[model samples]
Target: MSFISSPVDWTTWTPVIPATLMFIVKDGRILLIEKKRGLGAGKINGPGGKIDAGETPLESVMRETQEELCVLPINPRKLGELWFSMGDIPDILCHVYRADDFTGTPTETEEAVPLWYSLQSIPYQRMWEDDIHWLPLLLEDKTFLGKFVFEGDSMQWSHVETGVAW
Candidate 1:
């Protein structure tokens, strides 16, 4: 199930795990997190986690955001989907979302530390390599689909397409 090459057959690819990520963007800043555990620990990213049994991606995103950041995102909208193949780990499919509003304060938890960065100041170097390819599209309110292959913390290959519908 390796996808460490270009022109991956995405139509036939299936993920072993389904996850979600949510970003709260407002006032020229986006809410990100310094992950404290699990995959991508110590990296900056949005609040999200694996989808629980019987839970929709949207439900998982909202639940994860509250558990990690103590905030409930308002009017979150689906923006894109990402598929990842990391060597030695099961394939993952992540649903990404964005919300312009939220209730409650962004607080740190055992899972993550809340952080806000201006649109022009995203610290890409400290985030996942694939983020640099598709995050811009999310900020511009464009839909996207991305696939990536990684070995450890280094990305081996990637494909990204914008203006996708669902």
Candidate 2:
């Protein structure tokens, strides 16, 4: 199938503002999930989802983690953001967060299978392509924001910055 390019007039493509939560550890370990269904189905991702109206990015992250993994995240720090765009398609404003400590054990929901992996050995093959770009910074204890262009599941290019601290 022919792909739709970005820069398409704002008349098409729905807006996708997704928020993600990554629980980080000192040894480079991170919390991840195996998708149970939809879109990025079957791939691994941090616990997160669409940000609802009236909820801050942090609130969304916390809610999503609780809903998706049955865990209560503690003090989620806003590490960075990603403005995903391609051609003139649409925009997915993603705000990323990190919180290694939390309450409760990770459990599966209808959305994902909770799991963890060492930072040095994250299963990148099972995650969205863009994750490999900025995940390292977060694991390094540095906060940053990133811009990425993706075609379905592959990244075309990326631009990032160590954004101001929150």
TM-score each candidate.
0.95, 0.83
Clashing pairs in 1: none
Clashing pairs for predicted structure model 2, backbone only:
6-86, 6-87, 6-88, 6-89, 7-87, 7-88, 8-88, 28-119
Candidate 2 residue lDDT tens string, 47-156: 88778888988888888889889998777788887677654445787778888688888899999898888777899888888877788887776788666667777676
Q: In model 2, what lDDT does residue 67 have?
A: 86
Lowest lDDT 10-mer window, candidate 2? 1-10
**Which TM-score value belongs to model 1?**
0.95
After the best TM-score superposition of candidate 2, give how far the Cα of residue 111 lies from its true spot, in angstroms. Answer: 0.3
Task: Name model 1 segments beyond 4 Å from true.
Answer: 1-8
